[model samples]
Target: MTNLDFLLPKSSPTDLRSIVWPRPMTVLVTAPHPDDFDAIGVTLKYLKNQGHDIHALVAETGSGIDKVYGAGMTQEEKRQLRVREQTGSLRFFGLPDQNFRFLNLNNAPDDQVVDDEANRLFLEKLIRQIHPDLLFMPHGNDSNRAHRDMANMMKAIASKVEWPIALLFNSDVKTIGMKKDFYVGFDEADAQWKAQLLRYHDSQHQRNLRDRKYGFDDRVLMLNRKTATELGIREPYAASFEIDIL
Candidate 1:
């Protein structure tokens, strides 16, 4: 049986997209890991549901994860497993593989996500390419260094390009201290998608931080639910952000 079969049901003959085509929006979401899309899956769905043309950008393919979090799994195993899981999870969001852009960036071996010349150049180029009306990234409050690095890079990109679009921030369990300035509500399908995405990173979940059997279930669930509830709206899920008007 397929690994995700129990969590994500097969696609229905007809999805509601026909009614929402020509979705009028330009959005860009940046994530540090494969499943972060899962963490904010609900918010993504809501934006898509609202006819926003969402573009997802995952900063790293996650080679460091196996070294840091997936100690038990070989680098190759962790890499392959994560890619497979992430691919399946993205499909659940109705996002084509192309929408799930994976950049080769990685956290510094010492944990600093360096924002040197190469990083700056890359960010500027990406912004020019996307030219999004709105940009979403992890909040600075996240404790994870990689996430924080990406957030700062977003800031740098905005400064370099004199960016004027709205900037949204989302959080992961390892991340904290984020406040909600805005929120997008999600439905049941979004929640299911999140579960499936979180399920992809079997390595991260296996640690003591999450649940034993479910592995990272507790951590992922706590972060997912709490973030959604913080929205103060009745959406099944929420993606929170702090905007910079400069």
Candidate 2:
């Protein structure tokens, strides 16, 4: 017997479609950096196909790529490149430029902290203006500091707001552990598109190769397959999310 057989029950698993929202709801997906969207690209595409008004919000300029990757380019140049790539990827996913918003906050070093008040205000304003019915953000326990901080900030902002919105936590590649409340399965076509969308983040892909890390395409597909298998899904690809009503 396989590991899944041991972890999961012997009986057939129930199809948990409890998190499916009503049609045509607005969705806002938050990313700490440009390429981070790969974490939820599949689910975002699925929502878009369902005719939901979807928008992408990138919190940081991703200027720190020069430090993590190589040092050939200036921070400004790296930020611009990431922005262009992000725009291209969103466009490919059928989201127009107008639907994308960028908050050009500086990416602080490991020992330093960013301006929390400014970040909070930025997110609060967006939430007030867009008023998304559904919000997708990185899991709070993500290994990446930026992602973790963003998740916390989002939760804090949501708590302060009086609006009724659904919070869905997307699992990050940097996340070591996750508690998934639901899984969104995708067909081969959608999976292919997600892979294609990830390729648009050329700098990130190159950095992964240079650092000897798993390629974005392989990592995402592997995570999806693993999630689907654990959820007892017949299909082999899915994105998992933890849900909360706020």
For every candidate in turn, the CA RMSD to the true structure comes to 10.0, 6.7
For residues 73-157, what per-residue lDDT tens digits would candidate 1 score against the true structure?
A: 7554655666666777678678877676766654576533466679778767877887876677778787777778778887778
Number of the top-ranking candidate, with lDDT as the measure: 2
Q: Candidate 2, residues 87-116: lDDT per residue as tens digits?
A: 889888888888988777555764222548
Collision count for each candidate, in order? 3, 0
Deviation from native of the Cα of residue 161 in model 1, angstroms: 1.7
For all predicted structures, in order, the TM-scores are 0.74, 0.85
Candidate 2: the clashing residue pairs are: none
Q: Report the CA-based lDDT of candidate 1 relative to the real structure.
A: 0.62
